[model samples]
Target: MTGRKLFKSAKFQEVNTAVKKDGAAIFVDKEGQENLIIDNPYAIRYIHSYAEDTPFFLGLADGKLRGTKCGACNYVFATPRGNCQFCGETTKWVDLPLRGKVHTWTTCHFGGEAFLKETPYNLAMIEFEGANSVLLARLKDCKEEEIYVGMPVEARFSPQPQFSITDIWFVPAGAGPGQRSKK
Candidate 1:
């Protein structure tokens, strides 16, 4: 109440871009008053353990999509899981087909730091042939207007695996339409 304005702007440009260079970002509030926000850059390194999901990440490295199946209920997961949701049984790693249809999709206008550079990208939930669920991934090589439910897509993996989910994505396989998912 004593400092910054209570209202915001469309782009929230508190001040002109040329105002300063000491890690201060400018913003113009709704009242047309310039405001300055401090900005800083930092980085860190940490060890990671895939644990039970090691197979899934490793599968991506091998150009494969690995999902877990409940041996007791036969329920298939598009994303690997350690335990089954329906039967509470241990799941087994299984290979999933690379090609699938887009079950649902959205065009992202905003994203986190990792995807900020690729804002306005398409994301899709792909439905595989035998999987009961869908895999969520970035849809590449296509425009937002070109995306639709049931659109055919195929898995694409990074040539150099980073052992992360970003290692996998999907690209347009062909142009065709299928029925949209109800739910």
Candidate 2:
């Protein structure tokens, strides 16, 4: 009952809130449900250093797939981990084989705004021949009925990418493993 009616904004008209002892806001809903809300959640900022995974994004920009390989255990990771999961040793960047097979797949019927435009797209867990880590990439240029557990796929880079996972997607391979180009 001590809470007062706060000023109204276009988005939040009935912005009735109470100030807590620690300077937090308690938002009361129409049904008298009280919820503590942060005043400026977006005010906090963070600076992340993706130093280890730089090569992965850089390779995508250059139309080459890259991952990290363990020097100690000889394990290759498609996610570009700085250290090996098996041996806990330092890893070295290596160009990953573009050709792989769909280890598993699913058609996404619903998604967020960015992906909603491309609704019903297929995402697949692609397994490379030499790498232990599997790359999860969007399946493109193929039909749902044609997709199989072991269907051959090749990593395709976007002509102009924004330096994220969206830069690369997988498509039906032009040829099988033995017939694919080495480079």
Candidate 3:
């Protein structure tokens, strides 16, 4: 069947049409050749598995940075992996220093809807003192000219805890430990 003739068929009209911003459209057949487009991707229609990073969030609430150490190889992870990337061993909880040096950083010009109000923010890979792993965090309280590689910084927490990574950020070092976000 021709493309136009098949698209105009009664069965095709009943199927949802996935249209893109560029004016491209798609119709899924019974075999599901077309991709499913969700109207509200953020809406929670069902519960999924949760992340195993609860300790990391809890530590932030308690004004502390936490990581995980592999029991077999002693590999430290700032992002708190469930298993060691090297030795395939279970990891244990460990406390990370609040202070660190910026391994690398970038100023974000765009962000998600929740972060649209705070666009042009800074994100950095901070290597905490005495830790081999580098943690990714939002950088704050400094101007664009002030950020640099190997710049010293310390972790800061939001006054109102959200138990998420957003609860913590990094600011220029010597700003004191567990500093609260200015905004």
The global C-alpha lDDT for each of the candidates, from Candidate 1 onward, is 0.80, 0.77, 0.76
Candidate order, TM-score descending? 1, 3, 2
Worst 10 residues of 2 by lDDT: 7-16
Q: Candidate 3: worst 10 consecutive residues by lDDT?
A: 1-10
Measured over all alpha carbons after superposition, the RMSD of each candidate to the real structure, in angstroms, is 7.4, 7.8, 7.5
Number of clashing pairs per prediction, in order: 5, 0, 0
List residue ranges in candidate 3 displaced over 4 A: 1-42, 45-51, 176-180
Tell me the tens digit of each residue's lDDT in model 2 across 57-106. Answer: 88899999998999998999987899998889999999889999999999
Estimate, for each residue in 1-183, the C-alpha lDDT of model 3 and write its tens digit: 223212332264343343223233345556756533333334556654436877788789898888999988787888788888888888999999888899999998889987888888999999876566899999998878899999999877777787778899989988766555655
What does the lDDT read for residue 182 in candidate 2? 16
RMSD to the native, candidate 1?
7.4
Which of candidates 1 and 2 reaches a greater lDDT?
1
TM-score of 1: 0.73
Per-residue lDDT of 158 in model 2:
74
Steric clash count of candidate 3: 0
For candidate 1, give the lDDT. 0.80
**Segments in model 2 whose C-alpha atoms lie over 4 Å from true places:** 1-49, 175-183
